[model samples]
Target: MSKSIELKKKAAEIRIRLMQMIHKAKAGHTGGSLSNTDILTVLYYHTMRHNPMEPKWNERDRFIASKGHSVESLWCILADLGYFPSSELDTFSQFGTRLIGHPNNKVDGIEMNTGALGHGLPISVGMALAAKRYDNDYRVFCLMGDGEQAEGSVWEAAMAGSHYKLDNLVGIIDRNGLQISGSTEDVMGLDPLDKKWEAFGWHVVSIDGNDIDALIETFDKVPSVEGKPTLIIANTVKGKGVSFAENAINWHHRVPSEEELALAVQELQAQIESLDSKEEPCHE
Candidate 1:
C-alpha cells in the first residue's frame, strides 16, 4: 500500500480506538484527541525514528506531547505500536493506571511528564540543545495546542530555539481553535500566530493538519530552512472524523454518549473500509 493511504487507514483505526477508550473510561479530552490523531499517526508511523522495543534508545527521535490533556490518541498510538500492552488501555483513567489523563514519564515512550501548557516547547528546546551539546543527532518533536500559544513561556522557548539554532527541533501546533473552556480566540487571541513564531526567528509552515497526505509531505521536509527551528501550524478541526463532534466546542472534554459512540464507530469504520478499498487492485 502507498504510504499516505496506509497512514490514513491507521489514523482512522486509531481514532476508533481512542473514541472507544474515552467512551469506555467515561473520561477524556475527546475533541482535541480526534483533531490531532492524524498528526500523531504521521509522526509515530511515518516520520519519527524510534523502536517500540527500545523506547529509551539513545539515538531514537523524541516526541513531547505539549497539549497533554488530549493524550487518548497518543496512548492508543503507543500501545498500537507495541510500546506497551494494548490491553492496558482498559485501565485508562482508572485508579492507579499509568495511563492517566495526561502523559506520565513512567510510560516507556514518554520523554517528559506534561499536561500543563507551555512547558513542552521549553523542555523540547533543552532536548534539542542537549543534542547539539553532546553531539547527538536525534531530533525532538513537540506537539502543542493552539490555545497554549497564549502562554508567554512558549515564546521564550521559541527565542531560545532560534538563538541556539536548533534546527533538529520541530514544534507543531494542533490549531483546532477550541480549548477546554471555549474557542482560543474567545479566551486569548492568537491570530497572526505563525507570524509571531517567525518573528521569534523560527521557520513556520502552515497546512491542513487533518490531511494525511499533507501531514506526510510536510513532516518529510522538516527544517526546510537550515539554522532555524521549524514550526508547523497544523490547521485542524476539533472533533474531526465524527459527524456530530467536528469543530464543536462542547466536545472538547465531553465523552461521547453510548449512542454517540456507536455512531462515531460506524463513521470511522466506514472510513477504514474506504481506505482499504483504495489499496485493492482495480478489476478491468
Candidate 2:
C-alpha cells in the first residue's frame, strides 16, 4: 500500500481505538477527538520528525495538543507508535491511572499539561522562541480548537509568535465548528477567522480537515511564508465517521451505548476495508 493509504488505515484504527477508549473508560471528549483524528494521524504517522523510542530527542519536532480534551486519540496514537506500552491504554481514565482526562507531561510523549483551552498556543510560542534562540531546526506544532478562539491568550500568543518571526512554529486550529455549549458561531463569533489570523501576522491556509489527502498536502506546506507563523484552519465535522455522532454537539462529552459503539466500529471497519482494497497516490 502507498504511504497515504497506510496513514488512512492508521487513522481509521485510531478512531476505533478512540471510541473503544471512551466506551471502556466511560469518559472522553468523543466528538472533538473524532474530529481531530485525521490531523493527528498525518502529524504522527506521516509528518513531524520524532522517534517514539527517543521521544525526548532534542532535535525532534514538538507537537502540543492544545485542545487537550481531545487527547484520547493522541493517547492512542502515542501508544501505537511505541512511545509507551500499548498495555497502558487499559488504565485510561481510571482513578489511579496516569491516563486522565487531559494531556499531561507525565505521559512519555506529551510535551505539556493541557486542558484549559487557551494556554497551548502561548506555550508553543515559548518553545519555538527557545528553538530559535538555541539555533535549532525543530518546529513546534500546536493544535487548538475553534471554540478556543474565544480565548484572548490565543491571540496574544499569535502576536508573540509573529513578532519573533518563529517560522518554526505552526498553529493548527481544529475548526470543527462545534464546541461543548453549542456552535462556535453561536457561542462567540469567529466568522472572519482567516482575516483575523492575517491581521495577527500569520500566513493562513484553510483546508478540509477531514480529508486525509488534503490534510497531508496542507501540512506539507507549513510555514507557507518566511518570517511568519502558519495557521491552518481545518474545517471538520464535530463527530466524523459515526452516523449518529456527526455534527451532534452532545457527542462532545457523551458516551456511546453498546449498540452505538458496534455501529461506529462497523462504519470504520468498512472504511478500512475500502482503503485496504487499493493503493492510490496521495498528492494531487
Candidate 3:
C-alpha cells in the first residue's frame, strides 16, 4: 500500500481504538487522545525509529507522551505498531489491565508511566542526554499538551535541553487550545507559545496537528537547529475527527455513549473513504 494510504488506515484504526477503549473502560481522556491521534500516528507509524518486537531497544527512538491523560491514544498506536497484540487493547482501563488510564513502562512499548502534567519533557531530556553521552543515534520525542505548559517543569526542562545542547530531543506540543476547563487562552493564556520556547533557547515550529502531510514534513525536519532541542507547536483541536466532540471541552474526560461511539466510527470511516479517493496509485 502507498504510504499515504497506510497512514490514513493507521489513523482510522487509532480513532476506532481510542473510542472503543474509552467506551469499554467507561473512563478515559477522550478529547485529548482524539485530538492528538494524528500526531501520534505520524510518529509511531512513519517517523520514529523503534523495534516493536524488542520494545527495550536502546538504539530505538523514544516517545514520551507528556500529557499522559492521552495514554489511550498512545496505547492504540503502540498496539497498531505490533508492540502488543491489538486484542490487548480491549483490556484498556479494566481491572489489572496494563493498558491503564495513563501509560506505564511495564507495558511492552511504554517508555514511562506518566499522567501528571509537565513530566515527560524532563524525562525525555534525560533520555536524550543519555543517548548523547553513550554516542547513540536514538532520538527522544516528547509530546506535551498546550495546557501542560502551565507547569514550571516544562520550562525548566526546556532550559536544560538547550543548556545541554540536546538537539537529539524533539518536543511536539499538542496545542489544542482547550484543557479540562475552558479555552487555554481563558484558563492561562499560552499565547506567544512559540516565542516562549524560542526565548528558552530552543528552536520552534508550528503546524496543523491533524494534517498528515504537515506532520510528516515537520517531524522530518526535527532537531531544527544544531545545538538546540526542536519543538513543534502543533495546533490541534480537542476531540478532533469526531464532529460532536471536536473542540468540545466536556469530552476531555468524557466517556462516549453507545450512540456516540457509533457516530465516531462512522466519521472515521468517512475519513478513510476520503483518503482512499484522493490517494494516487503507488508506482513502485
Candidate lDDT scores, in order, read 0.94, 0.92, 0.89
Q: Which predicted model would earn the best TM-score? A: 1
Q: What is the Å distance of residue 15 in model 1 from its true position?
A: 0.5
Global Cα lDDT for candidate 1: 0.94
- Alpha carbon lDDT at 94, candidate 2: 93
Q: Between 1 and 2, whose TM-score is larger?
A: 1
User: Per-residue lDDT tens digits of candidate 1, residues 146-216?
Assistant: 99998999989999999999999999999999888888999999989988899999899999999999998
Per-prediction count of colliding residue pairs?
A: 0, 0, 0
TM agreement with the true structure for every prediction = 0.99, 0.97, 0.96
Ranking by lDDT: 1, 2, 3
Cα RMSD for candidate 3? Answer: 2.0
User: What local lDDT does model 1 show for residue 37?
Assistant: 96
Top candidate, metric lDDT: 1
Candidate 2: segments with Cα more than 4 A from true spot: 280-284
